[model samples]
Target: MITLIAGGTGSVKIARGLSKTVDDLIVIPNIADNIWLHGLYICPDIDTITYGLAGVLDKGRGWGVKDDTFVFMEQMKKLGQDHWFTIGDKDLALHLVRTNFLNEGKSLSWVTEWIRKKLSVSTTIMPASDDHIETRVETQSGDMHIQEYWVKNGAELDISNIMYKGIESAKVNAKAVEFIKNSELIIIAPGNPISSIGPIISLPAIRKELESKKDNVVAISPLIGNKAVSGPASKYMQIMGIESSPFGIASYYRDIASNLVISEFDNEYENRIRMLGIHIYKTNIVMEQSQDEIILSNYILNIVNKA
Candidate 1:
């Protein structure tokens, strides 16, 4: 079985692409971006993967259900709610059910599995942890949740500190660890390394697991030519004093990954990444369309097949 660690839009793209050609795949998504707003628990990463695998993702918006209406959010704004975090009508239904289940004392992993089954998604999807592990970005204004920084502020603020709140006390899900331990191959999807994959690896147990199986791990760099294909990953990397390029990504994952897949545009840095003892897999990492995703997915699988 193949296990993937991913978060948000980019991860979901790879998940959807891999789902078309691969079975027995499990995705462990970052939950640090989750937030509680307007009395609902909004898990952006989980919803992204769920919607993507279910073939109901809003491709144009990159998140939320396709053709979803924001009437609920509009009504909330009229009723004097913040509504800064937009929640569409159809999208709210999933949150409503998930919130209800949580209120009834259901584990997040259980609720996630239930949602996956409901959506008829064959690819298994698991949240990194059932506990709260919010990603907080300390900016010039103040420390705020990841959504506040990414959406409300347009990620324009210079981050002074990027922290994973509640991670020290957070417990890694056993099922997620089990899948990782038994996987034939592990791939860290192209997403924000800090905000997306950071929370999961921050946990001692999960980090240890990855370190033990580092030889079989491969990571797809979110950066190409010192720029991100989407989102503010490049900005965060810069704030952390890490170079905003494929070489920076290699340094970040060097301890946990043996191979790093980079875009052909960043071919110049392949030898530089190899200097860090990481094998390089060069390809067109940008997923502008479904075809691109399929090609990349097949490329990664072929590499695994050879192993």
Candidate 2:
């Protein structure tokens, strides 16, 4: 099976393309961006990938269901409720179902599988962990949930540290570890390494598994030049004391990934990344369109196939 570690919009784009071609694919999404809002469970990353795969995603907004109305959100606002995290009517329905299932004592992994199947999504999407682990951004003002930092505060604060609350007590999802250990190829999708992908690898079980299978692992750099294609990945990288460049990404994944994919725009860092003993593959990594995503997916698959 081809296993993908996915989170964030960039990762979801590639996951959508891979889903169309790879029948035996498994996607492990980060649950760190999950939150409880309006008495409902909200899984930002998981829902984005689920909607994208189900072909009902609002591509323009990069999240939520396409053509979904915000009447519920408007009504909530009229009631003086905090609706900073915009939830469309259709989007809220899924959250409601998920929350209900959780209250029924269902594990998150089980609920996620049920949701994917109910949406007619054939590709298997699993959370990194069933435990409640949250990503918190530490700033000068104070520590805030990742959603609050990004959506409520517009990600404007300078991050001093990032903490994965509940990770110390969290256990890696067993099936995720099994997939990573036995999969023929492992792709670390291009996402925010700090917040999107950090929480998954922060678990000792998952990290150790990847380290053991480093040869089969390939990481797609989120950085193009010194900036990320989307999100605040560059800022987080800098806060982590790593340069916001492809070279920096290579250094960060050096231990767990044997290969690194970078954009042609950042070819200057190819030699630098290679110096760290990582095999470099340069391409037009930006996927602004579905066709772009398909082409990149095929290219990466070919690279692994040849290996």
Cα-based TM-score, every candidate: 0.98, 0.98
Each model's Cα RMSD = 1.0, 0.9
**lDDT string, candidate 2, 1-307, tens digits:** 9999988686999998899778899999989999999899999999999999999999999999999999999999999999899999999999999999999999999999999999999999988789999999888889999999999999888888888999999988999999888898999999899899889888898999999988889899998899899988999888889899999998888888999989988868977888899999989989988998899889889888899
Report RMSD for candidate 2: 0.9
In Å, residue 244's CA in model 1 sits off its true spot by 0.7
Error of 1 at 210 (Å): 1.0
Alpha carbon lDDT of each predicted model: 0.90, 0.91
* Poorest lDDT segment (10 consecutive residues) of candidate 2: 264-273
Q: How close is candidate 1 to the true structure, as a TM-score?
A: 0.98
Leading candidate by lDDT: 2
Those runs of model 2 whose alpha carbons end farther than 4 Å from true positions after fitting are none
Model 2, position 259, has a per-residue lDDT of 92
lDDT of 1: 0.90
